[model samples]
Target: MPTTPLLSKYPEFGRARVYLFGLTAGCVTGVDFVASSMIGIAGAHIQGGVNAAPEEYLWAITVYAAAAVVANLVLGRIGTRITFRRYVLLSLLVFCTGALLCASANNISELVLARAVQGLGGGGLFAAARIIAQLVSEPNERLPIFVGFGLGSFTLTALAPWVSAELALSLGWRAIFLVQALVTVPLFAMVLTLFPRRREAPTTAQMGTLGWPAALAFGFGALLLLHGIEDFRLARIGLSGGETLALIVGAGLLAFALHWLHRHPDPWLDLRRLGSRRYLVGLGFYSLYYLISGGWNYLMPQFLQGGLGFNFQTTGMVLSLAGVVGLVGVMAHTFNFRRVFRRRRVIVIGFAVFAVAAALMSISAMPGASIAVLMPPMMLQSLTTALIMVQVASMTYLDFEPEDFVHAYQLKNIMREIATALGTGMTSQWLQTDRAIARNDLVGRINTFDLQTLAPELPRTSEVLARLSLQIDQQATLIACDHLFITLAGICIAAAGVVLYQRALA
Candidate 1:
């Protein structure tokens, strides 16, 4: 809340240009994160706008997310080739262009293409900002920047969703882009004026042209794998022949990309620099964290609205209130107890909280649960996200030296995109599959003759039958939701164990 903490340690508090720059970069990153979350949460509204099928809406989200992941390849290697000034200006151009196109899209195809272009631009901004911060600041001087950046970024990341939801639902899906515009435009202007135009001599350490082959394989391979998983049917064999082929091809390409990166002296993504069990463990947790968060981000609405029969207005209010609660709790944790627990302990505690929240949801997420009963888990989940997020970002790189920052940073960003996209997709796929199973299972228990004897419905009309079917659908869906939450609880508990296993942190 106070600006004083950021400037207190800086000698040049009179100017504080670096502090401002770091804060701006943090805002840019926040905007990007907000955009990613919005795609998942707002997919239904956006789908209606473009008349896209559920899968097509998913494809639209994936194209943007996939392109964002692809941006990592260039971000890691193109550091010296691209000037900071040029990168900022060019990226903002593409980013804003994509936003405009998204706002005006007439169909799903046009929207996906625009999102891809925008993702490439939005994706680079994060890695690029972190790179510049590392390049410009000394280790001793970096804490304030990190703190300020984290607070500013995570603050926006927490609240912007509520804000975006208000705008998109009240105005239209197009109104969501206004959030991007507000952040990116100011960032662009700041860079244009504040950043020095003089091009410094490039450093020669491990610089090279963009590795197109490696980038394509790594990014596209990931996209393919995600597509196969997201689109695969869950009945019977769980996948058709084409889906099976997609899964195999995608896995092969990813394996090949990893092999190539290991062998190549100057890989595009430089994942080899980060070859350690600790780092890998951290990456796995990071992916899982985002997946859980994103999956819930997609699922909570279904549980509340579709299952419990809440109106849209009530659901939105509860969600927005939950966001506010999360934001406040995040502030408290960030300020008062940020150092009270070690990163590993904090992570364990956070996931434990996640387990608690998910368990609560599972038990209480019944057909007629009250908003008051549902509100606690929603708020607690939000708190878990902020608490865990603060830990993972720093813990992942705590062991790496300064030189390895770029590679590690880019990889983590890549994981964030991939994880969130896959989280939403996989959760959606599971919901449908589980709902169908739940329907079949519920139907098996229902005796038509017993129902007829019990109620006789006062009539044998088509309307009565349809209403009975609808009730069954709602009850079945709620059963599926209960299963989903229990599974999430199990994952949270297991993740707590994984955090405890990291001896490096211990």
Candidate 2:
């Protein structure tokens, strides 16, 4: 039997064992962020020239995200069997291997495959941290630790893109993934040494605990949600037959998945406790609220680049500022969530602020806009999202029975993963389509008559076409971005109402 420490040395962590556990948890968070950053850098570099189609390189992101969905949903049961520490080590190895593969890949397809491999392994990081943090800490003491994990995760994500970009630029794209492998290797070894071994428990549910239906729900739901968003966006530019099929398939799958959860006795989703009413509402609000939040986060960089025409450094600076403000918000809410503000109230306020911030952002994207116009929305939205996330961490578990901790945690985790993926995917897809449609519309409207053929009354058709294309690209981008604000605002409003209703119940 592994010896249990009498007391946690870190107090917050509970003992030497727990502190080491936290370090491992931190690695999990850090590594996942690193994987994402590496891929982002690779994608950015590949898409650097205008001649490259941004969509072609985006496979790196989509494939990784798909892997995360599949792994996150399936790995819960795996943890029951393998033990969290062993799982962490295995996940790290897989991630490192994928990084190495990505580093060596010569074409976009190879890079995407490598990214998928990394995502498959990297999926365990966040879920495992949630479980381990719970396992290592006293029930009352878990929030701060989880918050710390969240902070580390966000901070790494915040800084990583820039760091990876710089590394890729300096050493070439392959080096970005290589750097991830190098950094994680030493930490992985240290973590294995300090972490305690898992105790075998025969009674625990296996990986197939929820059965295939639940698994299908999770996997297909993610695909559907993501694809649905893609379709919606593509609709603006007029969908291709394939894209339209994808949209329909994705929505149908998601709806069926959710329906199965609701109706089936042993449902795919653990919908049993959703009867709590508070949990259901809270979780729902969380999904919708984060959907908007994810969209805003996804769109911010594009806004900076396409609308404001800022360089990477300036974009990083803006993102960094948002991250810092968000960090402060998280800290503020964590300390205040219990004593002063109730969970629902805090979430509602967060949504209200988000709505306002999103609205501000929409206005900032207007034609002939200045950089200063963006600051207010950027700062406010970031801070607002941070506060909501903190409150969500606390509120999600507020009503959870001690025995139901694993189930409750897993449920929320799934919701967040699906929500963010679907939300961001859809937002991006729509933005792309909208931009394309607007460009096409503008191009169609431009007078194309040859000057000589028009009785000397019109400009040369080719020159006019060139000027129109440039104007269309820029103006269309602005217009599409403006529409994102509407989506953001509507989501915020719906979330606010949900939060209010949940607060009343709470």
Q: Candidate 1: how large is its RMSD? A: 3.6
List candidate 2 segments past 4 Å from native: 1-20, 33-44, 47-59, 194-196, 199-221, 234-270, 366-371, 441-472
Worst-scoring 10-residue span by lDDT in model 2: 5-14
CA lDDT scores, all candidates in order: 0.76, 0.66
Candidate 1 residue 337 Cα shift, in angstroms, is 7.4
Worst 10 residues of 1 by lDDT: 5-14
RMSD of each: 3.6, 5.3
TM-score of 2: 0.81
List residue ranges in candidate 1 displaced over 4 A: 1-19, 178-183, 194-199, 333-338, 443-469
lDDT of 2 at 305: 69
Encode model 1's per-residue lDDT on 1-506: one tens digit a residue: 63543333333343467657667777767767777767766676788989998778887777777888888767766666666556767887788888888888889999888888888888777777777767666655666566556666676766655665687768988887756766677778877765434236666764665768867787778888988777765565767688788789889988988898888787777766888676777788888899898888888877877788875557666776787776676556645543655678888988999999989999986777998888888888888766687566656676788768878888888988888888888888788889989999878887978678756756767887787788888888798889889999999999898788787654
The whole-model C-alpha lDDT of candidate 1 against the native structure comes to 0.76
User: Please, what is the TM-score per model?
Assistant: 0.88, 0.81
